[model samples]
Target: MTKPVRKAVFPVAGLGTRFLPATKTMAKEMLPVVDKPLIQYAVEEAAAAGIEYFIFVTGRGKHVLVEHFDHAFELEQLLGARGKTEALETLRAAIPAPGTVISTRQQNPLGLGHAVWCARAFIGEDEPFAVILPDDLILSDTPAIGQLIEAHAKVGGNVVATEDVPREHTNRYGILKVQSDDGRLARADGLVEKPKPEDAPSTLSIIGRYVLDATVMDRLGSIGKGSGGEIQLTDGMAATIDDGVPFHGLRFEGTRFDCGDKVGFLKANMAFALDRPDMRDDVAAFLKDMAAGL
Candidate 1:
């Protein structure tokens, strides 16, 4: 039986050195894409795909993040008394349903694999689960996680969100060796992490969304650290490929913003702000003036 995908893990333990000063006092996951924090967007995507349990793998100083999900009763009461009805509704929408969200600490800054390992008890056994990297914000007609969930139901091994990158850029991602390409989906023969440009098999690179089988956890458990000093999830994923457990790279319909990168982060802010009805006119006018002056 294909175990229903009910749980998701968000590894938000990284010390966002990329956005140093801003991240110094706050978790990068708390950074806003527009009005919503990066982590909120990830949870919303998973919730849209029918995820029943949300697990966050976090480090220290993330208390505010947990509070973000809790009931803001006092604040809500104040808003109600002040007659800020529409504003109050917006705040309520961001709060997840009671008892659905949970978090655990990842003691050391091991790596993505270690962060996931910390959630093993929550995942238990006999079920598939999802992992969403909050850094990959995909703007799409369909939610990005939903795309992976749809493919997971059909293909049944591991479904990952993938998009073609320039061949030269493949060196920065987990490049896939294609077994077959049915256009929308590419069945991968293997996953090669950060391969040199000439050695890369295909440009289909892994993105942030993953729907992984429970068996893969066993594989991840036995794997040793590779490439870097920390345990690598890519190494575990590559093992699944060797075990002949199927894996597919799905070219989802969307524009993906690599919000982990500074430039991509700026673009996401601009794109989302410009798309909002309330902010569009002023934002666009400001952009036009800046462009004309430049």
Candidate 2:
């Protein structure tokens, strides 16, 4: 039997240069989507998928991300005293069990592959692990990672969440060279990092959620700089493909918001806020007025 995916790695070390002043003092993952931070949403998603170990690959100035997962005694006490039961419960539930959530620093601002490599010691020689980029916020009835985990159980190999992109947008993503497609699962023969639209094999692009085998760590170790002179995750994954490991792209069930982009971030805030019972009416009205004014 294949080992269950017990651990998840969150690479939250990226500098949100696009958000500028807002991210100057805080980590990009600390930015709010609605009421919860992006990193919090990612952690909650992982937990919902039955992930036991949450390993955060952090960088300088990401202490706020670390503190968010910890209990706030004074705040909790204050909320309890004020008879705010729901708020208190929410706060308490945010914290993982002791030692369940741990952080390791990446030191340098390398690419996503290098960030995952930083967490190798934590993963050790254990079962397959997950890597989630908080910037790619997926809203679905079933968490995106849960979908990939389910596929991993069936496929028994590396599983990456994929979604179809316009052919013109191929250069913006790691394009998939699909060997077989059954709609939900695509057997991948190769992966191209940001290929030109004309050169793209298929428009099915790799998203942020990944359930990868432990051997990928070894592949990443041997992968030199790729694409943008960084250790691209696509390159490492392709190496596994060449070694005869079964790799697949799972057409995940969700709506993904690229929170790293300015427009996408704004859209996520609006969409999530509008989903809230308390804020829906107000946000809708505000949007109507703002649009009319324009």
Candidate 3:
């Protein structure tokens, strides 16, 4: 029987250099999309996917990322006493149950691979785990992480969320070398990290969501620095492929927003605002007027 994917690792250690002064004090993951933070959306997606234990790989001054999932007693009391029943319920709903969430620190800004390595102990030796990048906010009817988990169950090895990018833009992502593709799932012969347009084997690029077997952690520990002189997770995963591990890419159903970029952040805010029933009409009207004025 395949081991159930019970825990998820969230790599939230990056310094949001792009978002500057605003992130100087606040963790970028805490920036709100509509009303909820980016990290909240990732967590909610993981929870909906049946992830029971949430492990956050954090860095200096990123305590707010963990705190967001913690209960605020004073604030809850104030809401309850003021008879704000709806507000209180919403607040309570966001906090995970006691002992289910934990955080571990990545002491250096090494890379995405190192950040995930920091969560190795929690993943143990044989369990399958999920890694979610809060920077990639994916909106879909079914949670994005859940989609990867479903693919993992069917394939029983490492499965990454993939999307087709323009061939000219393949250099920006970890592109997959297709062994075979059947519309939704593509079996990868190999994965190349940010290959040049001409060298890219396929247009399918790996995104933020991943369902990985624990063995990949060992590979991460030994791989050399890649790409921008930092340990790259793609390198670690590609190594597993050489060991004959099954690697697949799932074309998940979602519209992904890269919230790490300023333009992308603004777009995510607008898209998410337009998604809410309470605010959609007003937001659409405002956008229409703004477009007309421009």
Candidate 4:
């Protein structure tokens, strides 16, 4: 029987330099998308995909993130006194059950590869796992991680969620070199992180979600730094691909927002605000006033 991919790792150690000043004191993962923080969306996604245990590879100044997943007595009591049943439901929905969530520190700002390596102890030996980057806020009916997990069930190898990016924008992501094109599922021969446009293998960029084999932990071990003098996760995955281990990309149906980028973060906020009934009106009016000035 294929080992079930029941655990997920979230690499949230970044210093959110992009959203600095605001992020200097706070973790970007704690920033709210609607009512829930970015990390909450990712955890919920893993849970929806049938993942049982969640591992958060966190860093300094990320205490609020861990707290967000825990119970809040003051707020619960306030809601209880006010008879706010509906409001309480929303709060409960955002938080995962205690003990199901866990955290480990990624002491060094090494890179994504090192962050995953930090979770190795929690991951243990020879079971498949998933990784989600909070920066990639996937907008879809189903969580993007769920799509990758479903694909992993059929193939029993590494699976990465992919989406078409403008050919001109390939440098912004980890690009996949395809061995065969099967549309929604591509036979990935290799992957390169943030390649120059001329060097990029294909326009299908790897997003945040990945159903990774625990073997990847070995590949990540003491791996040499790539382009940015940072250990890239693509390097490890690329090693697996070259060894003839099957790897596939799932072209999930969704809008992806690179919440790590300033413009992308603003767009996500606007898009989410527009989706909320109460905020839609005020947010629209605010945008209109701001646009008229522009």
Worst 10 residues of 1 by lDDT: 225-234
Candidate that scores best on lDDT = 3
Highest TM-score model number: 3
For model 4, where is the 10-residue window of minimal lDDT? 89-98
Per-residue lDDT value at 108 in model 4: 87
Report every candidate's CA lDDT: 0.87, 0.92, 0.92, 0.86
* Clash-forming residue pairs, model 4: none
Query: What TM-score goes with each of the models?
Result: 0.96, 0.96, 0.98, 0.92
lDDT of 1: 0.87
Candidate 3, after superposition: displacement of residue 266 in Å? 1.4
CA lDDT for candidate 4: 0.86
lDDT of 2 at 45: 98
For residues 210-271, what per-residue lDDT tens digits would candidate 1 score against the true structure? 88877678877888776667777777777888888888889998889999999999999998
Ranking by TM-score: 3, 2, 1, 4
- Give the local distance difference test score of model 2: 0.92
